[model samples]
Target: MVARRRHRLIQRRKMLGFSQEQLAHQIGVERSTVVRWESGEREPRPWQRPRLADVLEVSLEEVDELLAAQVNEEPEAERLDFAMRNPAAVDLVTVAHLAQRVQQLNAQYDAAPSASLLADAGHCHSQVTLLRGFAPNGRIRRELCVSTAESAILMGQLVWDASQRRDHAVSVQYFDQAISAAREIRDPILEAHAQLRKGFVALYGTKTPKEGLRLCNETAIVGRAGSNVLSGLGFLHVGEAYAMLGERHDCERALGAAEESFARIHNDDEALHMFSPTQFDRLAGSCYLFLGVNDKAEQILTRSARSLVRWKKSQSIVLSNLTLAYIRQGKLEEACGTLHEAIDLIAETRGGGGLNTAFTAGREMSPWRHEPWVQEISDRLFALMTT
Candidate 1:
């Protein structure tokens, strides 16, 4: 069953001005088939997806995302039903459902509002926590605890994001719980994720570079124990913390280590979800921006921006940083244009990271506040706040 609710297909259909019947006819399928596909009851056959993609004017990759969106919108009722029907058989099926649901929710993190998703995510976390308490002995219980760790980490993320990166204490509490749970299973990857998340709270939310750096180093150590790819990803954050500290030499070395790790990464690595193809460049761009090398930052961020379209919140952050790079370089018109684009994305997603970046960029433009375009941007931001 679908475990997340995303409306990519529905939005695409409306954008193309096609009704279910019309799309079905164009794709040579029954109207019911279109309804089923859109409603998450069924997926199109492999052979049929190409035609569907063509009709929807989406690429094969985008078609996959759209289909995944439809398939993951599973209802809470179904999970409760499973729990009720086979309290005795809840070992495998229930664990599988919860794992998939948590993963799906995490996948939507970049595009969905944390506030909109918090209740459902919290409910899932509670279910996992309850199951952990009464779960049967041995392997099943261990697996359930692992899932619980993941769910707890996700909860911490959602809570922090929903609070606009405030509520650091509560968020860190969840992360600590997640870390303890992972340690129970001796799962370094899970523990590393928790540490990295806690590092985020330190760096962004609390503005504690020392604590963030310490957590980042610890995360890298744990990741190195299990997977080189994950280690490299952790080092990227280490580099970020160093940049924030204005430690140029240390930042460069950390970034180089991250590159080496990236080079060693294979397709079979665990915790690959934490690594993004755009990660190094994106972080590198930010590092340069922090170091006041606006030209280099612009070069990197502009390139990464083009490749980050699918991740709306990530793209918004890149665009905001790119705007800052332009503003620092006195490229006033370019900065104004890019800020508008970032604002558009922030309006749609309300992503905390993006929202934070937007405001930071605006604050940096205070010297230009009297410019007509700058005034216009300020008005837009005010509207965004009131809205």
Candidate 2:
């Protein structure tokens, strides 16, 4: 196979008048390491990224794009053509492969642009749908449908994120399709997961806390039969909705119930896609932020933000909330610093939740627009808009 050239990296390096050895020397790496990276034989480490970005005079997000382009030059369809061509081969093993592919794309959701993965995810979803129709056994067919529902939900999320959460109608339609697919397979867990995502649309996209609360309650009911983790997550969203509505008593009660459910969660729970351990504190921090408890929000978010470093998209949301908490407390410098972190994560992930939170943080900073730090942050936000 011919080696794939990192054209963007090469162009940037040459534009900056640097040879491979000089560039590597500047970043304290071996010239062979630079050669390997440019030849697509190696990738830059996370710790080395900032310096690489500085040397290339490119944003970290741009570096990510360049790397992804190099690594995935071949379309996903080409890689999975065998499965698509021989739908009759749609057994448990094939299903496992499809599910693994979906998981791989899902893992990139927090680190890569949504548009980058949307095509492959859509193709994978379509293949799964086709395979289910050709599946010889009821068990295989049902499993395929489960995977289809997951793919549909992931497509909805990617579309929403790619559109910056502005295309609510399309996202909702995908969720509805996923819900129907799940119902057809009689998988309450999958159906509940779809409903939970719909709640997110209602809460964040439509700005309807009451509707979000109702959907979240429904999710909790179905999730109870499926997964303790998902049920707890549903109640956590319910608490968030209550907080949005300024129902302090109800919010606290729902949060307590969520905590109880979380404590009962075990490793055997399904709905792995919809649940995470960091979720409780993340949502709790957002709830406190909504309820005007800045101190409490800051406390929870600061701690949770550290733990969420592995998930840049989630960490961005936490950082956004922490920025808001700081802003509310008149900690302008700290708020500005956190806002920058959130914006940087947004540039990398382009996730809807983080983007919306970053913008919200910007709007909240308007009162202090005269401050140099606030103005500098505003400039950063402006650059994001133009880009």
Candidate 3:
């Protein structure tokens, strides 16, 4: 017999755009194991439920509801719409549903065009904001506030990227709003991240390293109270800001502080997911490049490029920097070859950061524009621009 609980579970997974294999990969289970779970032949272990809950964007209790037999009830969407229309009726369940929707949208942001996600993301943010105003209980209100901050951060990233980093003021406004919500909730980690994003704008968008240094320092200080992932991340950028100012000694000192912070990050740290193994090398390489240490930059970026397999957007940026490192050292052929790899990633992800960096690397290779390989890359760049 087909279990009703299995049907609901399958339905929920599909509605959130997760195929069986995709969901299985996310939860670190075999496809066969996922099939057995959906067949109601087994239950996830207690230790596994948290990760499962995170992937499904539901609470542990709700994961149980999906595993057990159930009674007749309104579809979550119908109930959510009613709750949204009557905000005083909002509850934890409704808040959870909204949060899940945001997660679904965010999952697509890295791989999809920012313009494509803006309408749905904006609508969802509006609904969350409306519900936050009239949420019935303190607990419910707090949940909505968290959702607001999360959605606001996503909006800031999407808006900035969609504008090709041109709309700095608007994106900073969104980040500031997110910081306000985080502070109201007494969440230092959230506030620190929001500040760090603003630092990115100042450093890259406006080309102002002084302001970037101030904001990233603040993030590093606040993140220290939480986990080292954010603190290390803050100091990594701190080094970059110093490099932009052409202060090599200060940059290296900040990099040492960042490494020290990273050493303290344990497996169980809550912010571990925010870090990647190649991150330190990637930023350090870029810092050295800015400081005119091309040989050192090439060494670090080469290692980082080899290690970067995930986070394709970041991988592309690293490749672009690697290309620059090659060009500066008179390795024109190697530079062009590295750029091809970066361009492939840029084509796949359409990430603004990598796209911009790739162009910068292209401009630096102008001395050898007569070569066939150089012409080939220029053609690809033209196509990338039009598309």
C-alpha TM-scores of all predictions: 0.78, 0.76, 0.83
State each model's CA lDDT, in order.
0.83, 0.84, 0.86
Candidate 1 local accuracy as lDDT? Answer: 0.83
* Worst lDDT 10-window in candidate 2: 71-80
lDDT of 1 by residue, 1-387 (tens): 534433557656754446789889899999998888877778799999889889876689878877775344445467557665555455443565676677778877788887888998898888877777777776557767887898899889888878878889999999999999899889998999999999999989999988999999999899998888778878988998999999989999999999999888886677765677898999999999988888999999999998998899889999999999998898988999999999999898887887788888899899989988889999988887776
Model with the higher TM-score, candidate 2 or 3: 3
For this target, which candidate reaches the highest TM-score against the unseen true structure?
A: 3
Over 4 Å off, model 3 = 1-70
- Model 1: weakest 10-residue lDDT segment is 1-10
lDDT-based ranking: 3, 2, 1
Alpha carbon lDDT at 270, candidate 3: 56
Per-model root-mean-square deviation over C-alphas: 10.3, 13.8, 5.0
Q: Could you give candidate 2's per-residue lDDT for residues 211-254 as a string of tens digits?
A: 99999999999999878877898899999999999998999999
Please give the distance, in angstroms, between residue 316's alpha carbon in candidate 1 and its true position after superposition. 0.9
